[model samples]
Structures are given as structure tokens and as C-alpha cells.
Target: MTDGQFAPTVHDDIELARKMLIGGEWVGAISGKTFPVYDPADGRVIVEVPAGDAADVDRAVAAARAAFAPGGPWRSMTPQARGKLIWKLADLVEQNAERLSMLDSIDSGKPINEMRFFDVPFSVDVLRYYAGWPTKITGDTIPISYPAASGGRFHAYTLKEPVGVVGAIVPWNLPLLMAIKKLAPALATGCTVVIKPAKQTPISIALLAWRCEGSFTLNIAVIGSNITGLKRTRIRPPTA
Candidate 1:
């Protein structure tokens, strides 16, 4: 289909949606399994997306772990630097709002006009707002007293650091908006992410993942049946 002929409408066949995005790579399901994606407009099959499983989740988690490790580009960047990148991403999204909204409407079966005028623009603004917070996050200086010292001199302060490796599982209702909302805050604080977009509306999330490549260190994964496994994973490492 030509670019000008492309319209924001869900495909009639659900098998058309059968695909998986794991670690920024789009591929078929682990076992070549597929699930139907319904068109809420008429309760018809729009497409079939890859039926992701345990192994796929593991792979995505590992990718996110690597991205969040010390010395990794995402982990090594300063908070402000990371925040700036997120803001840039937000800008890109804003610039491509029309296309993104179209994708979102097609994938989620939302009204194209509403997605264009409301959902997409609001989501972009949310990302931009969160982007400004990193520059303002600062530690507090604490006053301390050492009574037993000859010449009492004590200084203490707390440093707020980014929690690493966020795994976000967004619902299908507002796939694009929810993904961006989760992504902006997590990345702004210097955390790498593995986003498991809803199986039904996975295309828009996959498109976002594709767009984010080389712009930031992000891992995109699909959650088929094992939602529980992803829920058990923590945003940060457990305290000792």
C-alpha cells in the first residue's frame, strides 16, 4: 500500500497481527504460536500477535538487565543527560503525533479522531513534564553532631539514586499512552526498561520500540500468557 493510501483502521484478519517484539527485535512467537487480536469496533478478528511465553520473557529480562548494568550506556549516563534524551524522545513523538496516533487507533480500535486530538498529545505532554524532573532531583544535606570528638566536625547527606531495570506491563485499553507514561519516568531516572505491551494492541508498542532504537537503551517484549511471571519481577533489586 502507498503511504498516502494508508488509513487508520484495524485490519479485518486477526492473523495479520501475529508478531512478537523481543529485545527490540520483531519476530514470530517462540513456538510459532499466535493469538487473535479483536477489533472492538465490530468484535472481529483484526490480527494475530505472537503468543509469547516464559522463554521470551526471560530473554527480554536479560536484555534489560544488560542495559541497566554498571558502565552500560544507560546506567553510566548522568541523570540530566538521561532526562534530556527522554525529552528528545518526547519531542520526536510529538513531531510524529499524527502517525503515532493513527497507529494507536488502528492497534487499539480507538476512535482515530480522539486518539489524534486527545490521547497522543496528552501522552507527549506527560513525557515532557516528567523529563524536567531529573534536573531538579537533588539530595538533602543533613546536620550532624559528634560530641566525643576533640574538635567536633561532622557532615552527612543522602543521595537519591535511580533504581535500575524497570519492567512495565501496560494494559490494552490505552497501549501507546500507558507505555509512554511508564517509559518517561523510568528512563528519566536512569533506569533501563523492558516494556511488555498488551498482546492485543502490541503493534503500536512495537512501533514505538522500533522508533526508540539507537535513541535510548530500551528492551521491548511481549507477554502472551504468563503475566504473573512479569509481575513478580521488581523494578529495583531487592534490599539485603
Candidate 2:
């Protein structure tokens, strides 16, 4: 809906579900457990999200590996093609600006004007900026020579490539913007990703995954389990 469609307020009127996105599909937690997400401004239960734990992580990671593995769609794609996909995402983000902006504002208890005017716009810019980067990635040869084991000197050069799959674990604070920040760069670099949005605010991210699924394989699977081996920084609410 347009800003005018919402008319007097930006509070969104939409239906949200409690599920996780894995391998391009949405499903309930593997354990079938769920948690309530409340509107921060008031203590009202807005939605229920799958309570993902370690098992979910394993599923997502495996799917990501397959999508980014050699011969996979993302792996076989050219950097330019990857850039084009990212650009497409930028277009989608622009098209859904109002809805996404309103979503994060309500979910995070932030001001609508702030999210609509600043956060959402900045995220689009970041996506656009990174969208231009995929095709421009380059490497240069070094003037310094490298001596071989046999004492022969030769010029050295370096090349860059995508690092395969990526995992984007996002926070509830500014969900859309932060998600775009991580996702845009990863996609630009041709790395497939499995993104886990904060349970408290996952609607926007769920929408993003669904939107992209039409274009990419998105080998997403349900990941309610918390897989280990990654460091996580907790974001605490501001102190008085």
C-alpha cells in the first residue's frame, strides 16, 4: 500500500505468520515451538515466530552450502549476473519502501518518519551502492617479485573471489536496514546466504526472502535450531 493508502497512520495492516525461511520455503520450527512478538509501543502480541534453535541452523547451513557450491546457480553465475540480481533486489526494496519502512518502525518502536525518511532510504542506497560493486571487483599484479624455491624470481599477482555461502544473523533494531547491509554485500560478491532475522521482528525479512525466491533458487530450509561455531554479539536496549 502507498503512504496515502495508509492515510492517517503508517501502522501497517497485514497478516504475519510464525515461521522460518529455509531453502526458499517458510515452515514452522522443527520442534514446532513458537514465541510471541509484541509491538514495542504497547504490550500487545503482534505475531508469533518460530522459536528456532540449533537444529534449524544445521539445516540452513547445509542448504547454503549446496547453493554456493561449485555448479550451483549462484556459483555458476557471473559476477555481472550477481550484480544484476542485487540490482533487482534494490528495485524491489524501492518498490516496497513504504511497507518495509512501516514494518520496522512498528516492530522496533521507532518513529515512522525516522524509519521512512532515514533508515529505509539509507538501506536502498547501500543496496544500490553495493549493487555497483560486484562487476567492479578487481585485483592488481604486484611489482615485487617472488623468488621460487629454485631461486628464480617471478612477478606476483592476486585474484579475488566469493567466499561461498554466508550466514546473516540479523537484529531486531532497524531490521530492514541491517539486513540489507549484510545481504547486499554478500549477494554482490556472489556468495549465497542464509539469513536469520531477529525473532522479535521478522516480517520484513520473511517478505524479502519470499520476494527473492521467485528469482533465485534460495535453497532455504527451516532453521529453528541454533548451530554453533559463530560468534554473536547481543544488542541490548539503550540504558537510561
Candidate 3:
């Protein structure tokens, strides 16, 4: 081996993508428009990714809503099972730490050392921390003040429940970590998610989203733009 050879700086062997993650599949935007992502270090186009708009966002939201619906695979999973899935995701992050660190470094032009030391580990930590939340999330019983209105002998309690689909819009500066911060808790709490990674740095998020494939009941999609808000539903606390 030559002593003067430098470590590999380009990742030609790694396959990058120009699609978005929608409905558990890698797909292109309906408009077929793609915007180039530049390597911050050299200003050269690293890759082109789908330039998703409202339509793409809607598709992702629909998928998330279906996954979050009653009796759906993601919703029907027991809390303990959900926790295990999240823990598995954490393991996946750890396993791909090096690749992820490289992607972030290339995308954001941050030093590889920073991504390796901070962003990557923190993302894994966030997922692991939230993994324990599923089993621990609990509701409590409360004393009723209007007993007369309740036949003078009624009980009241609250059930902590999922808020359905979550929309996560993360910044480019710390793409991986910020995305995990929004996603880990949502996954732990039994909600599906639609993530819009900032346009400048979508590659790492795309990879992370695809990593969820075959890992669990897929409950996440990576795309662009904003999904329409969920209809407001007032859930009354249970009473007996």
C-alpha cells in the first residue's frame, strides 16, 4: 500500500437516487420535474431529486392516513411491538452510521468528523430514547366533579392516543438529526409520518426513509411540500 494515498473522498460506488419515498415505494414526482443537488464542497451537481409539489405531498399524506387508520397494520400493532420496531430502526441507523455520516457531510459540506461525532450518534440516541416511550405512555383516571350529571356514580378516565399522521419539515443544516427528532417520537407514539426534508439536502433523508422498507409496518414517506391539515376531531375522554 502506498503511504501517500489519501482516503477516498468521492463515493462513486454508492448508488444515489432521484426519487421520493411515497406509499412505501420509491417514486418520481408526477410532474417529472427534478432539481439538482450540489455538493456544497465543489458546487457540482451531486444528484437530482424529485421536485415534489402539492400532489406528491397529498399522496404521502394519504398513505400515512391509511397506515394510521383504525385496524390498519401500523395502528393495530401493540405498543410493545411498536417500541420494538422503533428500536430496530435505531439499530439500522447505527449500522449505517458511516454511510449516513458521509452523505450528510457531502450534502451540507460539514466536516466528516462533525457528522460522525455528533449528528449520526445523536440521531441513533433520539430513536433509542423514544423507543421506550410506547410502553410508558399512559392515561390516568380522574375524579368527576359533576357526579349528579353522571347518575352520581360514574368514573372518568383518559386514554392517551395517537394524533394520526404527522408532518415533519426539517431543515438542511442538520438534516438527519432534525428529521429523527420529529420522526422518532411520532413513531413511538403510534402515529404515521410524512417528512419533507429540505430541498437542498434530500438524499440522506431519502436513504433513511428507504431503510424503513421491510423493517415494520411502513408508516413513513419522504417527499416535498405540505400536506393538507387533518380535519379537526374532538375526542371525548372515556367515561363509565
Candidate 4:
């Protein structure tokens, strides 16, 4: 997080990292258990990260639910203010493009150049594109074609609002961009998220989660390795 760059590894961003982001804080699992993340290119173990279970999932879901609660910042902010914050998060993604790409490359064994060129840029674009949506969402008042009872007029309308907390599980392939696809619109529309990363490509998502913790007033939680017992509630918010 120093100098707007995340260098979690000691060897110049070559190693996988060991932390989970939950409730806007970087921490370890409650059970203190971890699993190895290996570099695909060399089949070498890069780092060991938290192996979260149903308990961790519960903790994360609680955080997201609270963040989406009536008085939370994510819920209470005006649409315009929310838009501004989402746009700011996009800017932060662009700002940390290099570090994010590096994390993805080391963890997924993807080429650094492609990650820098495509994944990072697309993530920024997706975020920026969705950032403009908060102020644009509108509801409509529908006119009924039926006669009103007792000759009284009736009004029918549809209100477009964020549904609730989102539980996102992303695959290892294209981790960064995939997470962004799930995250941007949800955040822009005033919904909170609890996301999990695949065991193989957990680095990039963790990195982005860390960046998000610093970038926005978001309650983003990252469950590690597996998604066991995370299906108790809503998996995807309506806004997403």
C-alpha cells in the first residue's frame, strides 16, 4: 500500500501473498489455517494463504450485510456521491495497474505483459463504465390501462433500487477482470459484496481487495481457497 503500489512479496513481486481482506481490513483466518499457492510455470510453491471455511464465510457475510444496512455509508450515500466514489475507485485501479498485473502474473502464471495490457486496462474500463450508472438509474411511473375502482385514480410505479448483499465467487482464470465485472456495478448501485477467489489464482483478487479497502468506503470481504457453505444467502445482488 506504500506509494500507491502493493508489493506484498519480498522478492520484487515474485512471491504469492498471505492475507485475506474482510470488513475492509487485512487479516488472517480465524482458525489460522492456510493452503499453498503455487506458481504454475515452475510448479513451485509461492506462498501460503488463509484457507477459510464456513465460519469465515459467515464473518464476511455479516460484514457485507452490515455495510448494506440502512445507515451504512454504502447505503446512505446519495447516488451522485456514490457515483463519485465508484469513479474514484476506477482511478485507483488505473493507478495500481502495474502492481495488480504483477500479482496476477505471479499467482496465475499468466504473462505479465498481457495482464498489464489487457486485464488491467479492461478492469479499469469496466469500472469506469459502470461508475456512470449510479446517477443514471431511474424508475418509472406506469399508467394503468384498467379502470380505477369507484372512479378513483390509481398510480403504479416501479422503483429501481439495489437488492441486497452480493456473494461473488470468481474462477482462477482471469481473476482480476472477472472480479471487477462482479464488483463495479454492485458497488455503483449501493450494494455490498462478499467475494471468494479460486484456490489457484487467489493472489490478484486478494490484491484488488486490499486496494479496494484503501480506495473506497466499502465493506469487501475475501474468503480464501474454498467457498464451502457460502450459499446460505443471496449469491448475486440484483444490481449486479
Cα RMSD to native, each candidate? 4.6, 7.1, 6.9, 4.9
TM-score ranking from best candidate downward: 4, 3, 2, 1
Candidate 3 vs candidate 4: which has greater lDDT?
3
Candidate 2 lDDT, tens digit per residue, 46-160? 6667776555666666667767778877778787877777788888878878877777776688888888888888988998899899888888888674455556666788888
Give the alpha carbon lDDT tens digit for every residue of 57-144 in model 1.
6666676676667876766777688677778788778876776776667657788888888878888898889889888778988877
The candidate that achieves the highest lDDT relative to the unseen native structure: 3
Q: What TM-score fits each model?
A: 0.80, 0.81, 0.86, 0.86
Worst 10 residues of 2 by lDDT: 231-240
Q: What is the C-alpha lDDT of each candidate?
A: 0.66, 0.68, 0.76, 0.75
Poorest lDDT segment (10 consecutive residues) of candidate 1 = 8-17
Q: For model 1, what is the alpha-carbon lDDT of residue 197?
A: 75
What value does the lDDT take at residue 233 in candidate 1? 56
Model 1 deviation from the true structure expressed as Cα RMSD, one decimal place: 4.6
* Per-residue lDDT of candidate 4, residues 35-128 (tens digit): 8877788787777878877767777777788778898777778988887777887888898888888878877878999998999999989988
lDDT string for model 3 (1-240, tens) is: 122222443243123457777787778888888777777777777766777766676677787877777987887789899999989989988988888888888778899889889999999999999999999999989987794576575678999898988888888899899999999999999888888877777777766776777565467877742222222322121121
lDDT of 1: 0.66
Report the Cα lDDT for candidate 2: 0.68
**Clashes in model 4: which pairs?**
none
